[model samples]
Target: MKEFRAAVEAGDFEGLGELLAEDVVFRSPVAFKPYEGKPIVAAILRGVGRVFTEFRYVRELADADGGGSALVFETVVDGVSVNGIDLIRTNDAGLVSELTVMVRPLSGANALATAMSAQFDQIVAEASGASS
Candidate 1:
């Protein structure tokens, strides 16, 4: 969890990727379908790092059984202040296997959805351009 927090603080996508399992799943606040696999999850996380500003963790709680962790955070997205929580579950190998994100406030969620959609589009465009 320390490594995960450090990676998040540093906005290091590569470092975060290293901490995730190959079959990691990411549940988004806006998206209906949870993103599956490391590559897709990594891309979404990278986009989130870009979209969220003034992000800070408010609280962190580890399960007594050491099975998972919950982190509460606050951030600004598209000029809207938002509160969020990250529920992370790790596998036996200590690699993050699942991460669920929940955000609050309707306005903030809307703003975040817009921003993330744009980020994902940009990512797709860049990847396509690179492939071309």
Candidate 2:
């Protein structure tokens, strides 16, 4: 999880990609269906990097079983403050296998959704281009 935090804090998408499993699953706070695969998830996170401002992790909770970790963070989207958590589970190889994100407050969530929605096309295109 140290690697994940470091990569995110540094806004290093290539490094982030290196830490994810090939078949990693990503659960978005605003999306109903989870996105799969490293390329796509990396692309989505890239979009997030573009949308969020003043992002920082405030707290981190590690699972007793050494299986997962929850990272609590805060950021601004469209001038709205958003509080969120990233639930990350790793495989035996220490590569992120699943990532679930949750955010709070109606206004912040709506702002996040709206902002991300605007980037969907670019995200999909990047992901597809990477896979190709």
Candidate 3:
């Protein structure tokens, strides 16, 4: 969890991927569909890293069994202050298999959605161009 926090705090987007499992799943705060697989999940995480500013983790609680943890954080997006929680579940190997993010208030969630949509579009365009 320390490594994960360091990566996020430092905005090490590439390094974040190393913490996820190959079949990782991500549940976004505003998105209805859960993103599946490492590539898409990683892309969303990277997009979030780019979109949010002044991010700070306020609290973290790890399960007694060490299989899961929850981190509460604060950030600003498009000038809207947002409070969020990340619920992370890991496999026996300590690879994150599921990550669910919940953010508030409504204004911040909307701002995040708008920004992330643009980022996702750019990611798609870059991937498409690379394959061409």
Q: Which of the two candidates, 2 or 3, achieves a greater TM-score against the reference?
A: 2
- For model 1, the local distance difference test gives 0.84
Task: Show pairs that collide, candidate 2.
Answer: none
Which consecutive 10 residues in model 1 have the weakest lDDT in total? 123-132
Error of 2 at 59 (Å): 0.3
User: Which sections of candidate 3 miss by over 4 Å?
Assistant: 125-132
Candidate 3 similarity to native, TM-score:
0.92
What candidate 2 gets wrong by more than 4 Å, as runs, is 130-132
Tens digit per residue, CA lDDT, model 2, 1-132: 999998898877666888999999999999999999998998898899989999999999999988899999999999999999999999999999999999998899999999999999988998989532
Scored by lDDT, model 2 comes in at 0.93
lDDT of 3: 0.85
- Each model's lDDT comes to 0.84, 0.93, 0.85
Give me candidate 2's TM-score against the actual structure.
0.95
Best by lDDT: 2
Error of 1 at 19 (Å): 0.9
lDDT for each residue of candidate 1 in 9-119, tens digit (9 for 90 to 100): 777855687888989999999989988887667667777888899998889999998879999999999899999999999999999999999999999999999999888
Note each model's CA RMSD in angstroms: 2.3, 1.7, 2.1
Off by over 4 Å in 1: 124-132
